[model samples]
Target: MKIGVLALQGAVAEHIRMLGLAGAEGVVIKRTEQLEELDGLIIPGGESTTIGKLMRTYGFIEAIREFSARRKPVFGTCAGMILVAKELSGQEEAHLGLMDIRVARNAFGRQRESFETDLAVKGMENTVRAVFIRAPLIESVGGNVDVLSVYQDQIVAARQEHLLAASFHPELTDDYGFHSYFLDMVRQYR
Candidate 1:
């Protein structure tokens, strides 16, 4: 399967590397046209405001939403989670608004509060390593959403149909469990 890492900002190469390690051909998606050849897409960590602005400026907002409307899988990490959410705490609009969840931006605090840990993701046989860096948290999820992992009693990972979201940077660690899991989602949907 060919998966894409949104290249507008943050963690693009790292995500592509992890996807490659997971046995999927990964591409850097700098334009909406690249979405045509991809079975799935990953929006990596970055500043939510900047990502949102770029997505709008580059015309990815509607394009990605249309892609997801077709049931193509999309995985969001860190600020990406904030972008994919339908609602954001104290925020006016969402970037993609494809996932049926509410997110709280930077709910995990600042740079000094960043940490790494292993997460017991639902449906996966073992734990996956996660790196949280000024990450957002899922404050609430709609009925269709499933909470996949949690940390310190806070929701960190979730899935809603073809959409997957994580509050941490899954590509920072050697564990490709999350990437592998997303490929499975793509295969299933494809």
Candidate 2:
């Protein structure tokens, strides 16, 4: 099982470390061709606009859109979640728009507001300590998206077929369950 972590920016090392811990082959993806051989990909949290622009500057935006279109699993976190959101309100930026949802950027305020909380994620019984850093809260989910977890009436995590998005930084937490779940999805789909 080979997984590529979007090395454009943000949390790349953590995801690569977690993938190694999971006994899966991990690679940092920079070039467009690096995406070709992966079983799955992880789009980590960062400045959405910068990442999005870098993806295009590096000619990866359309490639990613195409990659996910084939029904392969891709898990996006935080800024990654913003990139995957179908529509973004109040933020002028470009994104992959792979997931069926709308997002509100900096929903939790700035970096100083960064905090952690235990969330009751679906399919995982234990309270997952989710790390939120300049995270975007999901405004609404489309009919096709499954609401996987919620916080304060807002959708925090969701899955739409092969695409998964989370408002928190699961990569920052010790819990690798979400990563494992995404890998399982990759295994099942592949």
In Å, residue 187's CA in model 2 sits off its true spot by: 1.0
- Which pairs in model 1 have colliding backbones? none
Query: In model 2, where is the ten-residue run with the lowest total lDDT?
Result: 90-99
lDDT score of residue 53 within candidate 1: 92
User: Model 1 over residues 1-190: C-alpha lDDT tens digits?
Assistant: 9999999999999999999999999999999999999999999999989988999999999999999999999999999999999999997877788998999988889999999999999999999999999989999999989999989899999999999999999899999999999999999999
Residue pairs with backbone atoms closer than 3 Å in model 2 (clashes): none
- Rate residue 91 of model 1 by lDDT: 73
* Residue range with the least summed lDDT across 10 consecutive positions in model 1: 91-100
Q: Which digits, one per residue and each the tens of the lDDT, describe model 2 over residues 82-125?
A: 98888999866548878889999999889999999989888776
- Residue 129, model 1: lDDT of 92
Each prediction's TM-score against the native?
Answer: 0.99, 0.96
> How big is the positional error of residue 19 in model 2, measured in Å on the Cα after superposition?
1.5
